[model samples]
Target: MPEVPQPVNDNTIKVRQLSHYQFSWVAGEPGQNGTYTLQLVLDQGAWEEVLTLTADDADALQDLLVNTSVVHYDVERRTLLFGVTPAGE
Candidate 1:
């Protein structure tokens, strides 16, 4: 038998830096809900975490990422620049 996925209850992990991410969708059987899996690689590949989200939640996240402005890193300043302005400029 395949292993069942356990629910995450009162557990949290903080990711400071994200190196990579991947999204996966699994179709369910008749009268069942599909699954969305999000894999996150953090801290320059030091750690990896996987999250399972519902269809609504996944769509919300996708919309947020799609609508958000682009982010850039400043090589000279060594900081992340969000949008057109680098905070307090």
Candidate 2:
């Protein structure tokens, strides 16, 4: 058996929401802006804007953020460990 690669400090990660159960965007950078439009694709599907950052710098909609549908993720890790599960039981 193997252990999951847990986030050493998930708190550092920041996410901007767009709507409830709709679209939520996470970014490695800080703050929201017109250039920060989150291009997200849930389950590796089509890409869509989770949060519309335009005009003045504003945060993403809290209701629009979705974590379960993390279609894509660019994680930054210092030391990561990989593993594999048994093919057959």
Candidate 3:
């Protein structure tokens, strides 16, 4: 007999795992009023503009997600960097 998978809770639904991810900060054009856009790429295919971060927001986010696999950003140039921390860190 095969055991069926169970949901953790009524509101919890299991879905496909994200195999890979990428993040980047795009600088707004000259007249865009100094706004920055954070973009995310999933599984090397799908694309999503997750959020827009202000200068202060980006700084705070960098500190919060320091333990994650990859983190890269330049405050001056507004360039986004990406890297993956090895497994079992």
TM-score, prediction 3: 0.36
The global C-alpha lDDT for each of the candidates, from Candidate 1 onward, is: 0.59, 0.34, 0.48
**Model 1 bad stretches (over 4 Å):** 1-14, 66-89
Give the Å error, residue 65, model 3: 4.1
TM-score of each: 0.53, 0.21, 0.36
The residue-by-residue lDDT of candidate 1 on 1-89, one tens digit each, is 97745663223333234456678999999999889987756556655667688988678766754555553333334333334555889
Q: Which ten residues in a row have the lowest lDDT in candidate 2?
A: 75-84
Candidate 2 residue lDDT tens string, 1-89 = 88756664444433322122233334545564324444444223422234455423233232223323222232333211122234795
Q: State which candidate, 1 or 2, has the greater lDDT.
A: 1
Better of 2 and 3 by lDDT: 3
Better model by TM-score: candidate 2 vs candidate 3: 3
Over the full model, what C-alpha lDDT does candidate 3 score relative to the true structure? 0.48
User: How close is each model in CA RMSD to the real structure?
Assistant: 14.2, 13.0, 9.9
Higher-TM-score candidate among 1 and 3? 1
